[model samples]
Target: MLKSILSFYYQMQVFMFNWIDVEKLVGLFSFEQYDPVVFGTSFFLFYFFAFLFVFRILAKTKDLKVWTIIFFSIFFYYKAAGIYFLLLVFSAIFNFYIGQWIFNSKNENFRRIIFFASIFVNLGVLVYFKYTNFLLEILTDLQVGQFNPLTIFLPIGISFYTFKAMSYVIEIYMEMLEPVKSLRNFSLFIFFFPNVLMGPIDRASEFLPQIEGDFSVSKEDIGRAVFLIIVGLIKKHVIADYIGLNFVDRVFEVPLRFTGTENLLAIYGYSIQIYCDFSGYTDMALGIALLLGFKMRKNFNFPFMANSVMNYWQRWHMSLSLWLLDYLFKPLQMGLRNMRGFGNAFAVLITFTTVGLWHGANWNFVIFGLIHSVFIIFSMLTKPLRTKFYDKVGLANSKVVNFFQIVFTFHLLMFSGVFFRAISFDSALEVFHQVFTFMKPEVFPQFLESNTFIIILIVLGYIGHFTPQKIVDKITSLITRMPVVMQALLIAVVIWIVIQVKSADIQPFIYFQF
Candidate 1:
């Protein structure tokens, strides 16, 4: 029965991905004759059943069930992760063995050789895929030796999983945790389906240890998982997609066409759009992991509420941020302990710059990263003045200060985001110039009129900021208490609604290509 189930699962995955031949698929699907629902439904159903199969297999792992599931999980990832699947598998195997070798080997030279190779091999992959093109473009303008661009498809989660693999090695080497005994357990940690495509990327210490234990399901846990799934659904389809497709996307595509006020509103809309899109993806990932009886860590903590760049890092993309703090920030801080204040400042700047480059290979990402480094550096330089001002004003936590801090951070982050958003530096500057020139109070109303949903999205987006993670879980948990029949009925209605509003143009997850 499991074999048949697995076979059926694999077959559907192959069929849905008919995109391995993008040209052939496009040729077959003439617009006049195309049906978007057909493709979307195929994917939605494929994932749903795949989840069911994983649940069933995981429920009983007497033989090689875990490995079998891992096989298909990689197979499943291919639909989304694409060529990155090979890189993920290789990185996992590399780290898994290196971690064990380092832990078990007596030969100092061998361990160092393997360990150094693991770091560079993994980082080299990240650099090549994520930054190669960005570098080539810069070199081309400099009239350096002709920058020959070799077209490469970046593996989807290369940055995420590579960082994860690095964390594993560093943790193991540092004696923070022991290495895994089984390759299966290690691979599962690396390629766990829930966090593979988009992640609150888990560490081996936190995630792998749990895998070695028993498989027990809880009703309360089940309830929270269900609720998380629901919340994730609402965030993605209702909030992110609804606003992005209807409003934010339209304005950004043609910034010059809009008035100054419209440009401002459009930027505001994008700010909301990105947060919703990214946070919504993380929520869905977390909720799904919860359903499968795994607890992924929090990735976002209402980052906009944060007043300082340092504080913002604490709140946003927390998994990635925390990963950096542990692996990069702390190490640099500790390493530079002997240096004067200048050393500490330099280390912080360098670390944050690396943080930006980690996102992508673009110069804008570098600038985006550098902008934060500048904020951090400036704040550090005026540390005494900052503390004095706060003490004098009796307003460190005052409402007005909080509001302006938020406003200032929002614009600061927004401009950096614009740099990140534009295809090139010139485009970014054009948007900046137009942003200033297009000014008119009337533009706000016109922009709002054009994208009314976005204004509502912004309000709802902030409301989301206040909800505690615990409550989000508890709420999701409460929903799971409904009878299975009712639960199915609710899901059915949601599926129906999703189908009704579905467009023929199926936009892949924006981050998937990266």
Candidate 2:
């Protein structure tokens, strides 16, 4: 018996040593993966826990907290973008100094020059990375030059970070925000990993102050963070991924293969899928930031509830919309003020066209932008007429009328989503073609039978979306009040559900491409 025990112990030691391959362990930290690290993954969760552990250890030291976060954040970006992470570092350094220069300049003319130069450099980088192939393609089609498309890796989150950087410089130039004194703090603002990929587009004025202040996390913050993260996971993995994989993708890929009813339902599915996909990411981003004791502005606000195209824009992607309004639309409107109503209309067109082009280099995105622009311009022009008609019909304050208005606005946006979600302009047209022409009502029963679960998810998704703010707040409060053990159990249960429901491959967030 003693001899057997000794042999077993020796064997176990050998096995343990063999299992621990130092090279493989180190490779895990290297930037050699084909896919970027994203939220809602086992890998991200593991690293995040490790990050929090280190964060808590250094909680009392402000310098350590800031530097540790910056280090982890840089590592996060390196994993996400590989060598391209250097671009983020460059952007932070470039923008910090530009902001300082803008703020320190005493001469108005020199300040304006510096500001424009900064804008040009910032936009120049964005356009080169995002639009180089696009411009080349356009030139190829136009026969201006026979050019092969150049290979360009769009650094993930370039659009988002570029906007953030630009906002910092612009705000400083306008004297709306003072330049941040510390380069490390400004770097943290840019490199803050949670919102770095897809953002609520944190402003320096708002986020820099938090960095300078003391770090503290309340019980309520913890509860809210857990709630948001869980809800976001459900939205992405349970609803968005499941529905998109099972239904919407099939129909959109080849609308001619399905009936009009299927096509119509697919359109509806896409609308919800995108909302859940995007807002889910925002939720997780916010939750993660909150856990770090930073708060980002809200990004989505139950956009489907909006009763007009304008209101829809206000509710959907609130951060980007506000950015456009403040930076693009307002300036354009000011420049075109002398044109009166035409100016407003033109500004709306120009601003939203930029919105479309900002989304992608494709004509489909342009159409998506144009559709909204036309409706917004129409809404602006017809506001008085609509109000008069509503007042005359005695339906201005009717809940029923408002409900229909919401429905109408939802469908209008859904219509534009065809262009937004399709592979190309022709594919978008094909979707409409099939929807209008392929009236196969005979397949309805079979479709309903086959897609029962998807239909149920869709219904539940909308129901959750339409849940009143009061109810959402109450649920949040209840979660906040729960015992620590209960919260842990809740999180464990939700994560289990996510693991069960998620597809074989994790669905990258929709806005990651943007």
Candidate 3:
């Protein structure tokens, strides 16, 4: 028993501490050469310790609490982003101070300069990291490889938090918010751990107030939080992880090896996998924040249920989408108000492409973004024709079009997601070819042979379907009615499950790469 206990602790330590200091490692090995496993492991351990150490120090100190949080946030952000975190801090501090500057500067021209500078500064960093590779390929194709080599790793969450900071700047420019008087709170807004990676891409107006306001947690709220975390765990580790291991990763790694149906299903699985993976991270983030006496914006809202591509974008990664709408789309939308037809189309393409390119410094991400832009643009263009077509068919209100619309949208997403998931343009094209080529009668039978996983997935779907809302409503309404002892026992069970089930296979959050 003693030997077993020691062995357990040893495994835990290995799991936590496996990967650390990537940019440092990359210095020795180069970026492409390091093991993904080692990098992920080091990150897990670094954040785990950082989260614990910061929690204890901040919990005990009032004077240094915010600063302590900010300090550790920077440290962990550094670990997560490598040296690129300097850019994150630079943006945050510059925006924090600039917002204050803008608020105080009553002069119209100076105010305008500050606002423009702030926007330019934020977007410059985003474009530099997010678009560098894209532009590199463009220049290479243009036979101009004279671009300076940038060996710098783009920091994690740069896209998300850059927007968060920009929103702060925008609000100041719009006279909607005063600059943060305290750098501590302002830093906290940008570096808050839960929303740090692959944000719901929270806005300053939404997140800042939560951190500043008083928060209370009930016993049932705790239970609800526990439930959300568990659900999130299953989504990420079980469903997403299994599919990733079994199909999506495999096919993408060697797309020509699989059939059309297999590739198609894998693509479908990946759409769910990514949604489950990403939104699962957000859920865990929210749940963790709840436990810490805070709230975050909901990142997803049953996006698959949307009837249109535009509606799908609105529902998915809502914080990021809304950020784009407020900062990117709306400005362009309003600016092009004078030039209606082509201008609107250009804005839609540019904004959605930017949204796609924001995902990575890759050509595939560009194509993915462009595909989505086309989806939205074509949807918008054909809206009248679609309405008229549905009416003429007398199926406007019929369940058939509704059903087909959902299916069509899901397929559109799956089709585009192939590009999103692929390692290269060729890989995505190969996956598409396999998806078309593998339509034999035997494929479906062979696929459904895994009754165990299918049943488990089905039950998981049912549980995931209703448990969250039911638990949240119940706990929110009747927390006081349940004794603390009961809540404690429930939470204990969840904690145990989290511990026991987290074996050697705890997959890192998928979006951590971006």
The model with the greatest lDDT is: 2
Off by over 4 Å in 2: 1-17, 21-23
Cα lDDT of model 3 by residue, 1-514, tens digit: 9999999999988776565655566553222322222212334435544665666444565435556556656655655555666776787789888998999998999999989987887888888876776677689889886676566556677778888888898988988887778887888888876677667677787777766654456665576566566556666666666666666788789878877767766776677778778877777777767766677787787787777788888888888888888878888988998888677888889998887777777778789889988998898889899889989988788887787888789789888888888989998888877766655557777777853464355346435543565665665446446566865566456546545544446665678666
User: What would you estimate as the lDDT of candidate 1?
Assistant: 0.72
Winning model by TM-score: 2
Count clashes in each candidate, considering only residues at least 3 apart in sequence or on different chains: 5, 0, 6
lDDT of 2 by residue, 411-514 (tens): 99999999999887888888898889987788888988988989988987898799899998888889999998999899889989999977668877888888
For candidate 3, give the lDDT: 0.72
TM-score for each model: 0.86, 0.96, 0.83
Where model 3 places Cα greater than 4 Å from the true spot, the runs are 1-68, 82-84, 146-149, 389-400, 450-505
* Quality of model 2 by C-alpha lDDT: 0.90
**Model 1 lowest lDDT segment of ten:** 31-40
lDDT of each: 0.72, 0.90, 0.72
* TM-score, ranked from best to worst: 2, 1, 3
